[model samples]
Target: MATINPVKFIQQVRAEVSKVVWPTRREVLLTTVMVFIMAALAAAFFAVVDLLIRTGLSGIYGIFG
Candidate 1:
């Protein structure tokens, strides 16, 4: 098995972390708003589809019954 060096590992981790480009506050807020908007739109679409399907099934039952 190879030997492990704790000090060298910590230094490498810090170096990589420093290279990361973190998102700005504006970008985070915009993306968060977009996510909420998309979620609401999706929920509205599914609700309409469900209503249409239920109405169709009820009509079909009424015709047969």
Candidate 2:
């Protein structure tokens, strides 16, 4: 592989960084809030599923034991 010069590499990195479309503060906040909401919903869903499974297993074991 060919080695890139340090100065050229730094210039290329800066050029790429400048081309990025960074999110605005409002957009960032909205996305963060959405993420939190989705995470909470997922946690609740898993908790309910876990409770159902545990109850089902307990009932089965109770009948057999």
Candidate 3:
């Protein structure tokens, strides 16, 4: 196994990072909006699931009552 020097490793990392394609501001905003939309959808799904579970448990209690 070859041992790496920290300074050389950091330089190599920086060189690779320079080659990355960064997103534009508008694209970032659009992605952020989509992320929020997805999060909202997930929350809504869990809310429906929670309501169904609560309703079912209440129905079981009603039977015992």
Over the stretch 5-57, how does candidate 1's per-residue lDDT look in tens digits? Answer: 99999999999999999999999999999999999999999999999999999
TM-score of each: 0.93, 0.87, 0.76
CA RMSD, predictions in order: 0.8, 1.4, 2.2
Give lDDT tens digits, candidate 3, residues 1-39. Answer: 999999999999999999999999999999999999999
lDDT of 3: 0.99
Runs in model 2 lying further than 4 Å from the true structure: 1-3
Task: Please tell me which model should have the higher TM-score, number 2 or number 3.
Answer: 2
Model 1 scores a TM of: 0.93
All candidates' lDDT scores?
0.99, 0.99, 0.99
Q: What are the per-model numbers of colliding residue pairs?
A: 0, 0, 0
Candidate 3 lDDT at 24 equals 100
Q: Give the clashing residue pairs of candidate 3, or none.
A: none
Clashes of 2: 0
For residue 1, model 3's alpha carbon misses the true position, in angstroms, by 9.0
Best-fitting candidate, scored by TM-score: 1
